[model samples]
Structures are given as C-alpha cells and as structure tokens.
Target: MSAELSGTEPNRTEPNGAELNGAQLDLALAELGEGSERWASTTLAARADLLARTGACVAAEAKRWVTAASRAKGLHKSSPLIGEEWLTGPYGVLTSLTALRRTLRAIDGGHSTLASRRFGRAPDGRVTVAVLPLNRYDGLLLHGFRAEAWLRPGVTAAQARDRAGLGQLTPTTNGGVGLVLGAGNISSIAPLDVLYELVAHNRVSILKLNPTFDGLLPVYRAAFAPLIEAGLLRIVTGGADVGGYLAHHPGISHVHITGSAATHDAIVFGGSRTDAPRFTKPISSELGGVSPIIVLPGRWSARDLRYQAEHVATMRLHNGGYNCIAGQVLVLSATWPQKAAFLEAVAVALAAAPTRRAWYPGSDGRMRAARTAYPAARLLPGGRLLVAVADSATPAASWSTDDILTTEYFAPVLGVVELQGSGQAYLDAAVETVNRDFLGTLGANILGLPSSIRRLGPGFEQAMARLRYGTIAINAWTGVGFLSAAAPWGAFPGHTMDNVQSGIGVVHNALLLDDVERTVVRGPFRPFPRSIAHGEWALLPKPPWFVSARSGALTARLLTEFAARPSARKLPRILAAAFRA
Candidate 1:
C-alpha cells in the first residue's frame, strides 16, 4: 500500500494528526520483534487473562477515548453526535475484546466455541453460523438484530470447527512481528487490527497509527497498556513515510493495513521503487469500496416507509459518511408502486437528519466530482447529496457511470440506481447489477418486509447466494457487521495482487472461523411502539446509531459501560437510555 492513506489532506479534514521519526520507529519495531516469541508461546489461559485486563483498561479509559475521538472529528464535547464516537470508538473495541476473551476461554477449557452458537443451513446447502445474539447480554443489548456467516459453498459445520483456530495448534511456530498500518477514519480500527494480529495469528504487533488518528494515541496507549507493558504490542504514530518504512522493515514478518486500494497497491507493488515488491511479506487489508443497499419492492405500511427512510438516511450519514460500509449506492426496483413516495420520504428524512461537518480529507474534491456527475444533485445542509438517476427505470441507465456510483466517495454522497423489474425478477436483476457494476466486494444490504421475503422463500436465499460480497445484510446496515467481532470483516476472499478490489483477508473475526463466504446481518423493519402494533415484537426503538437519535450520547455511554463490564443491574438503565433514543 502507499505510505499515505485516503483523507490525508489535513488542510481539509483535521489538524490534529501526528507523526513519528525514523529513530523511534526503528526502536519500536525492534521491541515488538523481541517479544514475538514470548507472545506466540503464551498459554491460552494467560492470553485470556491478558484480554480480560485489556477490557478493564479500556473501561477505565473509555470516557477519555470517546472525548479525544470527538475532538479529532470536529464534534464538540457537548454534541449529541459524540454518541457516534462512543459507539464506534470505545464501545466497539470493548465488545471485540470481550468476544476474543471468550474465544480464548473456550479453547482453554477444551470446549467448542460454537457449541452454544446458532447454526443453520442455507438453501444452497452451505453452513451458516449465527454471529449475533452472541449471548444474553448481546441479545438484550441489540434486541431484534441478528447476523450469520454463510460459509463458502459446500462447507459443513464440522469443517468450520475443524478449520478454526489455525495457529492455536502450534502457536510458537506462528510467531511473527505483524506490522499494522491503521485506518484513519474509525478510531477502533487501529486497536481492533492490533487485537486480531495478536489473538487470531499469534503475532506480536507494531501498530503505526494513521496520521489522522495521531491525537488519540494517548487514549489508545492507556486502553492497551497491558499488551504494551507485556511487550506484545508497540504503538507508533506517523503519516505515509513512517508507515512505508515500517511496512518494509527487516523485522516485520507480515503486514496488515486498513486504508485505500491505492495504499494497498503501492506497498505490494513497490510504489516509486520500480513497479515491484522490494520485500515480500504476507499483507492483508480491509479497503473501503462502493457498497450497495438493495431494497426489494414490498407491500409496506406508511410507518415502514418512514422508518425505513430514516434507516437509509442513517446508513448514508452515520459518522458523516466516512465509514467504509456506509450505504453508498441505493438500489431499488423502479416498478415498485411506492417508488416515488419512498424516494420523497428518503429526501425528507435525509434533510431532517442532524448536520455534521464533512470532516474527512479531500471531501471538497469528492463533493465537487459528485456535483459534476449529477448537475441536478440536491445539495443538502452538510455537503450531502440526494443524487438523481438519469433514467429511473432501466437496466442500461447511464446514471450508473458516475464516479459516485463506481468509486468510494468516502463522504456524504448517496446515488440511487433503479432496476426495471418487480418481485423475483427485481431481486435477480438487482443482484446482477451490483455484482457486475459495483467497484468493491466488501459489503451489500437487502431491505424488504417479512412477507416479501417469505414470498420469495428459497428464491430469496438463492439471490443472497448469488450476490458476491464479503458481508451481506438483510434489512440492516452492513456497518453492524463491522461492529460485531464474531463476523469476519474484509473483502470477499478471492483477490490477487494484480486486482485487489477491496484488498485481501479478513479481521475482527473473534470466533476465528475460516472458509467464510459472507456474513448476513438482519434487523427489524420497524422499531418499538410501531413494531408492537405491527406484531413484529422486536424491542428496537429509534436505534442510538441513527444520526438523528436524540439521546444517542447518553445511550451509547451506558451501552459502552455495560459492554466493558456487563451487569444485570445495569440492564434497566441501559434499556431506559436506549428506548429514550
């Protein structure tokens, strides 16, 4: 990958990014290499204990973690938008740690981690491992939300269990110094990558923070002090040059980065160093791409239209649309009777959502490109766009050619593409369109009602099987897959160095399952009071993740605390804050 990542233009994004020099970088890598053997040979029980202490440290630093992230991303301490910081920052990390610790404990106890997890068979005969509702705590914390991993075709549950914990059989032999070039946008990404390298691969890691997140180093250092103190991890900070050097250092046996495809190519192909790799190392990544959200035609209630509209809005605007999994393209059936009405509600909901700065680097240039592509694009409050489709009902619509449709905008830009069909025809066409035209394979989402899904039946699952994406979500934002540690988050498996669409490999898979084809996440169509009237009985209200959520900060704060240290006594207050949102 290139030494620098996307959103690197500090003149536009933020002014807080930091950097490290050559001497310190050299020392950090050496230190990490020195601990590689010890960390790899650490007993499973001790590893579990390390993660347990990590959780405590994270809990202790949770407030400062969110606060630092808030300031870095342009949110004031009092901004309710701090909730996004809380959830994506400290809360996500704690949950990942909690899951990893459980996996370690399970392996140490000589028990199957999947024994208590749910599993099912897709219509195509592939085994699917249920990833969410991971426990009573998760069930209550994220009521009505669920996710499952659809293993590679023909994989059985037995095969899945047999293949997991690849390095566990002989951890000492797997010891290596993994260099982690962290992502700039999400605060949790850096630490999450560190955890994956250590827990899943038995590697001591040297984490070189993205320049964009340099200011949050202190919070990260405090939260991960156990690993740092134990010599299993080293934290460094810098921009492109630093990362470039670290990625190629002699002591580094492997490298993993979460950035752009440009960065991935530069490193793998020797950017500015004769179009070839100067050093060989196993490198992995989770590069952002043009993710799609498919909405099948359904007989929906007025509340369904409104709530789903808000859901779509949240998907586009969350974290001010810097997220890799945020819904970039909206795929819909042009023949659906509710098309115009739904579009209208989406526009209204988008405008009604709270405003946040276009905080990422190069946003101005990207927004300009979007404006040039769609001259009629409506410029909403926060440089957001409700892009127009040139032909609202056609497979050959030229609107899909815009860079906004093909490239990862990494800003608040949503392009609506309508396919001409209804029912099963619409489903098949939508899947084909995305598979053929979308630029990346990281994630895709399908939104429809239970009745419509039931109507499609086997056809529905078959459609999901046909779509090629790493993580597929039904009636939910794919971002949830990124947060859930049990689900593997990365590009769809088969990509070579020549054409690394979303980069290669997976991370944050706490269960450590291999042979994963894609993870499917589902959520309630309606929330709370409306859900009860509709007999959908899922307890979700306006979820705190929604950008418009009123009590998001308070709710996420409570949720973060509970995740760090779950207690039955804390459930009532957490639920109160959640429902209040």
Candidate 2:
C-alpha cells in the first residue's frame, strides 16, 4: 500500500495544506449526496424537466463556454481549430439529452412497460442504469442506445411502480464525494467527469483541476454554475502536492482520473515517495495509449487517397499530437498494391498542414525516442515531420518489437508498419497482436475499401468482438468515436478496480455508469468523385475539398443549422455551399 495513504493518515491532516476543510467538503456532500433514492422515486417526467433545463442552459451559454475553452487550451479563437472543437466538444452531452427526451416521450405515449423498453447490459453481465445527471442534455444523447440494448421486461403507464433501478432516474445510493483529477490536454474531460459522477454513481463531485489549465478554473466554475448552485459540485486547483493530499484524504469517497498511465499507477500502486501502493478506495481512470490506425489497402481513386491522407495528418496534428485518440501506428495491408503511393500522398498532406505546438507533457522526450529508432524519419526540416514511415524493414521491422509500437510516443511521430497477407488475415492477425501485445486498450482505427469490408464480413464481426480495446473506429479514424457521443467510451472489456487502463467505467453515454466494455463500429462509403481518391493527390489544396479550412467552417455551420431543423428542401443549398467552400 502507498505510504501516503496507509499508516498515520486516518483522522490526521494530509501532507499538503488544506484549502477545503473537512467540514466544507462534508457540507457539500451532505447536500448533494442525500437525495439519490429520493430521485429514483421521482417520476421520469420530473427527471426530464431537470434535463431540459440543463440543455437550455448549455445551448444558451454555448458561445461563451466554447470561447473560454479555446482560450484556456491556447487555441486561436477564430481558427477552424476552435470552431471544430466547439461543434464536437459538448456533443456527447447534448446528444445524451436528446436521447433522454425521446425515451420520455415514448413513456408519455404509454410505452412505459419495462418489457416494452430496452435494457443496457455490461460486458460482465451486470444490468444497471443508475444515472447521475450532469445536465438535461446527458440523457437526451445516450438514451437511444441504452433503450435499444436494455429496458426492463415490463411497463407501467403511471410512474413505474416497480421499475428496474438505474435508468434515466437518478440512483438512491449516495456514493459520497469523489475526487476528480482532470486531464491537462482537454478541457471537456473535467466537465464530463463531473457529469459521470453526478449521473452514474450518485456522488458529489470535488474536481481537482489539472495545473496545466488552472487559469481556466473560474470559467469552468461559471459554466457549471447550475451544479455549484445546487451544491453538488466544487472546484479546487493546484499541483502535485494538492492532488496527492486529496487522493489520500478520507473525505474523498472515490477517485476518478484522466491522465497518464504513469500518473495513474503512481496514484493507485504507489511510486516514488509513496512507494507502498496503499489507497484502499475505489478509483476509476482513463490512461493514455498509442492508438493504432490500420489502413487496409484497396482499389480507389486519387481523391479517396488524398482524403484519407489528409485525415491522417489532421488526426496527428490535432492538439499537436497530444490526444489519446491520435493515430499512432499506421498499419498497412500488404495485399493492396497502392500502399507505396498512399504513403507518398500522406507526406504531401503533412507537409501542407500547419505545424502545431508540441504542448503535452513528455512530448519532447517521446518524439526524440521515436526519431532515434527511425533516423530516416523526416523531421520536417523546418517544421514537424510531414510524414514518417520506418524505412527498410527487412522482414523484421526494428520498430515492431521496440517502444514505437508498445509505448505511446504521444507526439507528431507517425509510425508505419507493413503486414503481408489477405485483408481478413492481416486484420485478424493485427487485432490479435495489438490486443495481446500493446500497452493500452484505449482506441484503434481501421481504414479499408467497401469491397474488402464486405469480403471480411463475418470475420470482421468476429474480429471486432475479439478486440480487447475500448473504442474501435472502422474506415474512419478513431477521433470520430470520441466525437460521437452515440457510442460509449472506455476499454472494450473494462477491467476490475485492481487494474484499469482505458478506465474502470464508461462515462460518455451517461448510462450504465459501471465498468463498461463497449465496442463502436462504423463504416463510410465513398461518394461519387471522392476527393480522397488514390491517384488524384496533387490537386488537394483546390476548392471542393473538405480538407480545406474554409470547407470545415462551412460544414460546421451547415450542420449546426441542419441540426437546428432537418429539412429536405435545405439539403441542396447546404450541399452547394459545401461544394463552394
């Protein structure tokens, strides 16, 4: 056990000076923690009312919230960068709200019987729906999948006299105050963690903001004023000492973290001065990983190739290659003859994309390590490497067995490894190799042709089922899974409290708040005259390409407008504007 938490800690003051006294923490919890069972007994209608108010609040404050997040993250306010994040960052929460509203509408229309509804089942066979509401938007976005998967076997027209526990309804069991250790790279994480605690586990949230963006804590507090006003949330800020003290405090009911695996291990297993691995409380974490983006070569036009290449660059360059979901390993299917050309196109795209700041912790050391392993890696001369593939692998790729594949370089280095075999064979082998050999089970991406996908059909399903990681992105990059709240986030097969990599429990969907092992599957077909074609790579910077920043803005605006109101007549105008942009 960790010495910081074990002996001489009970009823004694923590190592760091206290900012929030026990009484303050306790007072916050007593008010926020007492009404779980009571909430469970409340009608779904009442729950919907609360969620609606929360959604309205978010929508009303969307602009300010987004601007604050952009400033805090050091991103330019008007850049496509900020605009893109603004659209997708709070998407999960909004979608969850919509989902909840749909379910409630059905209930009002007499679909309340438990048997008539769907029930969510965990990877371990546990059935639960204990919801802690972060905002009204939480339920609207995630309830669709939950209802499809798990609803009780019976229904009642009048307030479910014998409804199964853990639906949109908040749980009665008060799990006390949880210490939320936020991530430095992304601002949305802290808020998302707060939502999970409130809706999933029925706990009062005590958020410890990562020092990386301590400057923005006041903005966060303001944005989340609803919860603060309810006395359900509190924000604290500091460095290691503050975090260490809070992690060990008895007042903390549970611990939730989103950061490095090293940090996670230090907190849970005890490293450095606290070398005994002693915290006996329940903790959940989503540690970082070297996510793989497998490119299955197949017949395609130059446009298709360009689109995929640019996407690869975007995924790598976004957040300056700091994202946990960033594409790390570029797995090539040897069966495809165009692999060489694809690599070249990727180089051109990377050279054109803007170089971003190398801001993540340990990014410098990790990037250097990657370069050392593959000296041939193009280090951008004046900019970051436009594209970096391991050169000359004589049947035994040096990087295959080294840290490149195992350790998440967490920088702008893109590692390419080629595999020889049929599409299914390569995919099956890669899945097995990655799951068994990789350090993390966070996320994985697959890029392939529709025909190849069809050929791999049942085998593909089998491979997806066998994957041990959390989020699986097929055809598209893994970032899509993170952006789309419709899917759950966490490891594919959630681990026990004893050990967790991608995290112990799922939080994105706002349902089934326990340790969830979720797999997300998606397939995209190329539209006619696809821009991401194989041969037409050079003319990528021209008009009609979505890769351009102008197009991205147009797309975001059009989608936002469409989401406000879906219309067939407006489709032509949106498409025309899309093409022009």
Best by lDDT: 1
Clashing residue pair totals per candidate (backbone < 3 A): 5, 63
Clashing pairs in 1: 1-263, 1-264, 1-267, 2-263, 3-240
| lDDT minimum window of 10 residues, candidate 1 | 5-14
Query: What is candidate 2's lDDT per residue for 110-154, written digit by digit as tens?
Result: 553242433444333334232322223323221111112211223
Candidate closest to the true structure, highest TM-score: 1
RMSD of each: 3.3, 6.9
Q: 404 in model 1: Cα distance from truth in Å?
A: 2.0
Candidate 1 wrong stretches, greater than 4 Å: 1-19, 272-279, 392-400, 532-535
Model 2 is weakest, by summed lDDT over 10 consecutive residues, at 142-151
User: Candidate 1 lDDT (Cα, whole model)?
Assistant: 0.83
* lDDT, candidate 2, at 397: 42
Model 1 per-residue lDDT tens digits across residues 1-581: 33432212211122344334566666777787777767766899998999999999999999998888887789888888899988899899999999988888887877667867788998678899998978888887788889998888888898787777756645666568888988889999989999988887888898878877878888888899999998888887656766677777677889898988888877777655344554468888889789888998988878799889888998888888888888988888877899889988888888888777777888888889888878998887656798866445444656546676679989888888888878899999889888888889999988888778889989998998888999888888888899898988988889866677887888988888888888889887777777676556688788899887889999999989888888999999888888777
